[model samples]
Target: AQTVTQSQPEMSVQEAETVTLSCTYDTSESDYYLFWYKQPPSRQMILVIRQEAYKQQNATENRFSVNFQKAAKSFSLKISDSQLGDAAMYFCAYRSAKTDKLIFGTGTRLQVFP
Candidate 1:
């Protein structure tokens, strides 16, 4: 069984600052995918970033970037220049190439202080 773990239940960041949310996973398969999904108050699941198991380079999308450590099975999200809109529930998700279902972490609530 594969699972994603988010040790931090909550995190706070000041506006225009940066914060890193930690995540770890346990999986047996060598080939898989990792994702960070943001669920805003609207409850829509939005893709923040994604990283492939085979890709050594980390993924980045504007303010969002990932620190993917395949050997340690760790994938963390860094939000640079955070804004109030960044405040949301961030879920770390894992998906295998074999399945369409994504297993998600408990999630971390990011609060952006104005």
Candidate 2:
């Protein structure tokens, strides 16, 4: 079975600094996708960034980016110039190309301290 691990239960970042959330996964499949989803207090899970295993380039979206280390099976999310609005519970997720299901890691709560 595939599993995602988030060692940090909570993280804090200053309003304008960068913060990285670590995630590692155990998967034997060669074809899969990694994602970072943000669930704010509203409880809606929004996609932050996504990376396909076949691509060597890390995925990026505005202030959010992913450091994808395929060989080590590490997918970390880096948020730059953080804002209070970015404070949320971030979940690292994995989806096999063959299935629509998403296997999620225990979430890391991000606190944006002004």
Model 1 local distance difference test score: 0.96
Where does candidate 2 clash, by residue pair? none
TM-scores for all predictions: 0.98, 0.98
Estimate, for each residue in 1-114, the C-alpha lDDT of model 1 and write its tens digit: 998999999999999999999999999999899999999999999999999999999999999999999989999999999999999999999998887679999999999999
lDDT of 2 by residue, 38-106 (tens): 999999999999999999999999999999999999999999999999999999999998875799999
Lowest lDDT sum, 10 consecutive residues, model 2, at 93-102
Candidate 1: worst-modelled 10 consecutive residues by lDDT: 93-102
lDDT score of residue 75 within candidate 1: 99
